[model samples]
Target chain A: MSVTSASPSHDRPHWLALDRLGVLITLILLSSFLLPFALFRANRILLGDGLPLLASMQPVAASVLLLALAFGVGAALLRLPALIKLAAGFGVLTILFIAMGLSAETLMPADNNYARVSPAAGFWVLVFGLALLVTDALTRLRLGPWTRIGILLGVCGAFWALLWSGLWNELSILKEYANRAPAFWNEARTHLLLAFGSVAIAAIVGIPLGILCYRVRPVRAALLNILNIVQTIPSIALFGLLIAPLAWVAANVPGAKASGISGIGVAPAVVALFAYSLLPIVSNTVVGLLGVSAPAVDAARGMGMTWLQRLVQVELPLAFPVILTGIRIVLVQNIGLTTIAALIGGGGFGVFVFQGIGQTAMDLVLLGAVPTVVLAFAAAVVLDAFVELTSRGGRRA
Target chain B: MKPGLLLRVFALALLIVLLVAPQAFRDFFALFVRPTQPPIYTQGNLLDITLSHLMIVAIAIGLSTMVAVSLAILVTRPFGAEFLPLSRAIANVGQTFPPVAVLALAVPMLGFGTAPTLVALFLYGLLPIFENTLTGLTTLPEDVMEASRGVGMTGWQRLTQVELPLALPIILAGIRLSTVIALATATIGSTVAARTLGEVIIAGLTTGNTAFVLQGGLIVGVLAVLIYDSLSALEKWLARRTGRLTRADA
Candidate 1:
């Protein structure tokens, strides 16, 4: 829009450049001692030591080569193409991953299985900094949501494929994954079960409660207040609170154990998750129902439609889109929250997280954290697409 | 008279009751737990822990609001419009990156203390405030903005006076959401050795002490309710003052 205002060269902003001196400086400074480029350990005792990128010749070469290209492009006094920037970012990421993998391969003793070779906080900082630069360039291109999602999936798929092909087998995180390969699928299954079960329960309970809250006058405050109160209780605290009562039920109630309702497992995890999921679903449902136009309801009523028929035929369809959006939020939120389920001995991906914490192993933590992030991201995207499709249909109607 | 005042009075009474519950019901909770241990959270002083929790939340939310609001303002400007997607992506990263993961990542760099927790909380609180501020500023009436500009008000003056003031209610709603989230999420800070209410729950989890867990949950839940109510009241007041509320009463 402001492109037409270019009377003087000074008034016009410069276009993109490859090195972007600022980005180059940032990358170098970030990869240097300002952040630990790599972590080292002798045996299982993780030493609080990090080596700069130049600590190893191969990595240093990689860094130098990358920086040289960046500097050459930047110093050429020519604006870089958007496509080139994207490709360069992709290349740099591949190089960074390979550099880390190569360093790990060389650093760890081949004979010793217990020795750990991991990237420290600095490595992560550099990765993030580079990622920010790449995303900035990508955003400047103004890609659509589907295109962005495709880029994400493509990058992730390639990385996973490389990992599966044994390219990153020597990396400490993959090693952690290697050890838990059998259990990983099971934990993933449990994680999904925890997420989906709670979402299902929340929807079943919340939709009706939402309708009731919308219809009733006095019930709204009391019901919403309770749900809000429940929501505000921290996830860990909520899980802790459920332990006693569920324990009591398991001990005293006949057939409770038979039904798999217990104090410290999926039962309490799902229950706490269900509680957490309710506020969004219920509030969204009420909001959606209330959002229906008055004239539509009036017309239905004038047509001699019963109250139930009016609700079933008119209100639900109008409200379905908003309700789906709420469910999307709940699903994504629950996916992340379910990681806490492992803290209570409820089987899920959080098992790796807590175990990693216990062992003070960052790699093990990634073993859990990465999958959870992916699951949550995927659920949010899929549900969002669903919401868009339905809402568009609603708008058309 | 006013319903807002009535709600505040009710909330205040409820708050007082909740704060006193642990001390008042120590003996009652002892029935649920074994007779050997104390029934209530007596490890770290409950009041002190609560104060620390509040302080941590306050500082984190304060920092996040400043950054988020500034970014929101920047993105809405003509110069920074290309950055709207960039800012949104950054905020999404903050939201979608699990706070626990952030804490775990932060721990190695900042070590085990409040610093890591603060980092995690700051990131977690960014999105809601940013989104709300953007929504508020961008949705201001074109006529109002034009009038301000026609009056020769500078960019800064228009922002500080016309834009922000009118957008206060919506911005406050966002801040309210952020604050509530920060309050609840702050409990996880204790896992990293931050002195928050989560310490009570974590201790209970470790030792199978249900009474300790209950005390922690009760205090946090009550605190959340009181803060939420007060913020909602503040938002309503802002809305009313700005003439945003057409319906007189609920």
Candidate 2:
């Protein structure tokens, strides 16, 4: 690699120039050495004793982990290429995950049904630090968008492969998942339905309302103000607020109860999600349409295109990326808010979360939380890619 | 009267009525209650619960603002610029992780009660403040920055007198958003045994008492809106003072 003469490192030694990757690697080493790597619990809900790295795992695994750490330090201290640093980071991370699983297996007594082994603070710190290193290397490499997405998929596939190999089966979280495999899938479905269903509905209604708002100033002001007020209400309070009104409707409205329009279940939950979703959708739509180039619209008009034709053929196409951004925001927000819906009997992954909270079973809580986070993160990355692609395409067109 | 003043007065009046004599709404609440169920939350003093809830939110927001602002400031500095991408990635990813899940996860480490709730709120509230502050700090006009340097001002002086004053409006806006989110999220802290308004709603849910649910929901909802409005007003005033009102509105 060619070094720029203006860089401070030319005047000083490379080490003195402040290596950020080295700082992260040092942090990872410190955390791995200083903190407990695993928790050994006699039973699921009880407090566990902290276990240090070597004590928590088999000797072979511990040695491998140590070797990986050594390699990371070497990569950090040396002025290695970004590509090598990235490979080292990924290798260290994979070893960390495998070692974590091995640690759990080593800690648990095979015949003891109640024994639980969970990752501790050190493990998490190492994972976070290593992930940062990998991200830093990736940023330095400056991969294209498609390459980044490919890497994302590859990382996800690695996690799937690891799990499929039963490496983490001994871990408490996986154990908890095994116990409620069916319920986990059930809740996963419910979570998706609640989050996606509401966003879909919001788009259908919000897009038209947004167009109307763009057409009429007064309605725009009044409607946006109302939605702002709605948005200000917390998810829990809004869900609770909907209960009384919907319960009344279910009691009095002829077909409401039979149609599942009750206060305490899916109906109110979906309604609340839908309400929370409208502001983002409608506002983004308006903003997007407003952002369409005036020249483009004028050209369409000059071509004798009707208003609808101009809107459909020109404006909406230009605005789709921004509107999709709004939908992405809504989808992620709804996924999170859906967890709270479990409070009112709207079943989702939150069922596991709340159930775990009630039972003081943190593994169960992780079972719910981990998946929700993964789902939301996946949605964000995929949507971000789509937004980037469409925006690029729009500029080209 | 101006709509702003009218809203303030209405909010003040409602808060006073709710605290001074909640019984004023008892009859109305009773409409939703069964004969046997209580018409209002009787398990805890509503004012005390509300105050404790506000206190929790205040502490969490205060802590988050300090840390987030400092982190943002650090990352924007020349020496710390290397960390900017990492910090940005963290703030963005953290927001996607739900507040409720964060709250639940904290329980394992800190155990139940206000401590875990505070930790969760602090973490969840960090992103908005950090992101906004970073934007404010990084987006200052290049000419203005040059002007400050041309005056022979020290780094500290430039930050304090020039950068901070110009960025205050955006920072305040971030605080407003964070506080509003904290207020809402704090309600869920009750699930982990923190003393918040959610206790009332949870009680209501368990007993099928619509009145109790409505009482808690109304108070929390109204409180959030009022705080949100006041903070927004403050932000607007700051923006106008800094001659950035139009941009702030945008």
Candidate 3:
């Protein structure tokens, strides 16, 4: 804490005050949207029955009250140790989750199992506020990457426990889940395959393209222009364009359909995802290879290494980090883009989102959207770690 | 003044004429391209739809540039330096959230229209501009910054007159990327009834009309390339202008 706080007087330490934190908490408390949050039928969120805050949810009110008081005190102190701030942020998140669980239990009349409660726009704003608070505190903590990963694992474990223990059985999103629990895994599997398959294909195609761009100057401009043009074609249109050609191939060719190359479904989804993944991967590959120093290559040649040996033993290792960075972008991006697969019956978490929108079910949308985000984030984190590990190995060598 | 710039101008003018009078394309499209299927997307005024699309993209990019550039400036400042990681995490979240998911979630609240699309586009646009701003400010030449300080310029003056002008090219590059991306993504807005070019594309998809899909795709693709080229020129013009200033100073 002193490390950060001990700024030179001339540098001007930015003050952390009670009123600033109070404003966030106050807004959460005072907002009308939070005051009369929605109570929905088990089936839908669009048809909301408003429930007044203090009257309908005593536990939630108390929790928020206690959180505000604690935050107010912390803010009044002006500065605190990093660990303490992190703990406070964690406590705020804990209170939010517990309040959500408690509201699920107490708010709905026990007699009617079909009744559900959905947090209103104000509740979402409060969630956003708490997230900002937590992010600020976590940055203050300055935890190492491994420790951050550990914290994420802990959070995930706790969340899983909450779900498995059925404490959130009454939550509207979980109700949506209860109906499609079996199919959810299938969709998840499809989403993963589509994302990863595209990455694999893109790396196979794009790395060579990048290398070609590096080696052949004349090929670079035309190839890049084509890829750029392809990149700008919106995914929806790209998907639509693929339909006709793919349908023709599937209809005319003897074995195309059997090979999963149909107009609609996983085939076209994977193709579109592959196209989207190419630009980043190819560009990165070019940048990484071009970035390798001439001296390093010369040294390898002087050592009597063959061109292949020089590339494998020197250039590739040096280029690995940048290449990995490109792969990371493509991987994360493909995870998000694969959600569109469900639009064409390719099947992913987007099925839930589109269906939910059709039914005006917010929880179902969350059910799909939340996992897709988590998957993308997790893929990014893992890829980043892998890149770091590989680069560290290169440095050691 | 460059031939490339002149060509871009001519191309843009032609595009405007085509969008405003797509009947201009209809006869030409029929003559040059073999329409495998009849285009059913000719009913709506393509100009109005294109303008609406551009308007939505403009609003989203404008809002994002303001917020993202401000946040970038803030986090790069001495007082707000610690918030850098938090800002990055927020931007990453914005990127990671699928626009479709945002649209689906927002439709219930905002109804089926541009509101949800705007929200999605704004969120999607944030990361590129934010990252670019951060890179531009942080990567300013250290000696140049010291020279500004040694010359006794205040922080605000140094930032506005020196740092920002030097960083303008990179920042513009980010904005260019964001704009192009937003233009492409805005087509999806039609799915939620935001009255976009994506309507034509979606209509084609549902009816399997290849001609309609081609028409929509061609317009959007051409628009992206033209905007991209124009922005690149602007970036180059800024760089050349700054280059002259630096040379004069030397």
**Which portions of model 3 miss their true places by more than 4 Å?**
A1-45, A50-53, A56-78, A111-114, B1-14, B23-37, B244-250
Q: Candidates' DockQ values?
A: 0.50, 0.70, 0.52
**Greater-DockQ candidate between 2 and 3:** 2
Query: After TM-score superposition, what is the CA distance of residue B101 in candidate 2 from its true location, in Å?
Result: 1.1
Error of 1 at B72 (Å): 2.0
Error of 3 at B228 (Å): 1.1
> TM-scores across all candidates?
0.88, 0.95, 0.89
Between candidates 1 and 3, the lDDT winner = 1
For B92-171, candidate 2 gives per-residue lDDT tens digits of 78888888889988988898899999999999989999999998898898899999999999999998899889888888
The residue-by-residue lDDT of candidate 1 on A1-397, one tens digit each, is 1122113335334543323433443655345457667787775446646776677337566576458446433422334544555566567667667777777877777689987778766666656655665665675676555666677789879788778777678777788888889899999999999999999999999999999999996898889878877888889989988988998899999999889988998989999999999988998899899998899899999999999999999898889989998998899888888888888888788888777777777677778888888888777766766677777778798
Clashes of each: 1, 0, 0
Q: Over the full model, what C-alpha lDDT does candidate 1 score relative to the true structure?
A: 0.78
Task: Select the stronger candidate by lDDT from 1 and 2.
Answer: 2
Shares of reference contacts reproduced by the candidates, in order, are: 0.53, 0.59, 0.56
Most TM-score-accurate candidate: 2
Candidate 1, residues B92-148: lDDT per residue as tens digits? 656666767777767656767899888888888889889888888888889889999
**Residue A240 in candidate 3, Cα distance off native in Å:** 0.4
Lowest lDDT block of 10, candidate 2 chain A: A1-10
Give the worst 10-residue stretch by lDDT in candidate 3 chain A. A1-10
